[model samples]
Target: MVKVTFHQDPVTLVGNEVKVGDNAPDFNVLTNDLGIKSLADYQGKIKLISVVPSIDTGVCSIQTNRFNEEAKELENVSVITVSMDLPFAQKRWREVNNVEDLELLSDHRDADFGEKYGVLIKELRLLARSIFVIDSNDKVTYVEYVHEVSEHPDYDKALEEAEKAE
Candidate 1:
């Protein structure tokens, strides 16, 4: 039950708290086309998962776009952005922002990703901002649970770990 702040107010996070060295949890998130994609879908590739409350928000947009830009250079890494936004909204946002290198997934159907990753904001039905770096073997190498939901994550550190995992 890790706690995070949405706007300087405490919020509850539901589900298991993931940590480095833990086997990455598999979750069924909707792809842009409404197809299901789980952690196993990315087997054999290092994963940089960026979790945000919603894709339309300012911090989330910047965070996702930064990773999308970086994804072009991370050849062996599969960068993904997960949010509670609908699949339609996720696709629209990606197209509007020209974010092509990363996968934008929706956890709206079920809070699977949000719950399994310990990022679900109980009161708001949104996910807390976080970053996860998983190695090719599906073991978590780095994890960042951003204390403030509106702030940015430690991108450099997460990217470094993803590169090393590759």
Candidate 2:
């Protein structure tokens, strides 16, 4: 149970706490087209997973866009942004913000991503802000569970590890 603060208030996070060297947990999340996707779907590529409480929020939008911009230069890396927002909303946000490089996924249907990744906010039904880098073998190479849900993640370190990942 990794605890994080949302708006400076403590919130409970459900599920296993993922760590470096651990096998990345597979999760069922929804694509912008409402299609089911799992971690295995990104096999053979380094994965940079950006988890946000909601995509519509300022911090979340900025975080997603930053990764989207960085993804263009990350060869063989599948950059994904996960949120508890609806698939329709994720699509709309991507269209409005012109975020095309990074795939925006929805965990709203069952929160499988959130729960499996230990980012699910029990009180709010949202995901805590976090970043995970998984290598081509599906082994986690880096994990950042942002202490404050409103704050930004350490993008540089996460990206660096993703680049180093095989």
Query: Top lDDT: which candidate number?
Result: 2
The sequence of per-residue lDDT tens digits that candidate 1 reaches over residues 1-166 is: 4669989999999999999999999999999899999999999999999999999999999999999999999978999999999999999999999999999999999999999999999999999999999999999999999999999999999899888995
- In terms of lDDT, the poorest run of 10 residues in model 1 is 1-10
Give lDDT tens digits, candidate 2, residues 1-166. 5669998999999999999999999999999999999998999999999999999999999999999999999999999999999999999999999998999999999989988999999999999999999999999999999999999999999999999999
TM-score (C-alpha, index-matched) for candidate 2: 0.98
Query: Model 2 clash pairs?
Result: none
Local distance difference test scores for all models: 0.94, 0.95
Which parts of model 1 are misplaced by more than 4 Å? none
C-alpha TM-score for every candidate: 0.98, 0.98
Give the clashing pairs for model 1. none
Q: Report model 1's TM-score to 2 decimal places.
A: 0.98
| Backbone collision tally, model 2 | 0
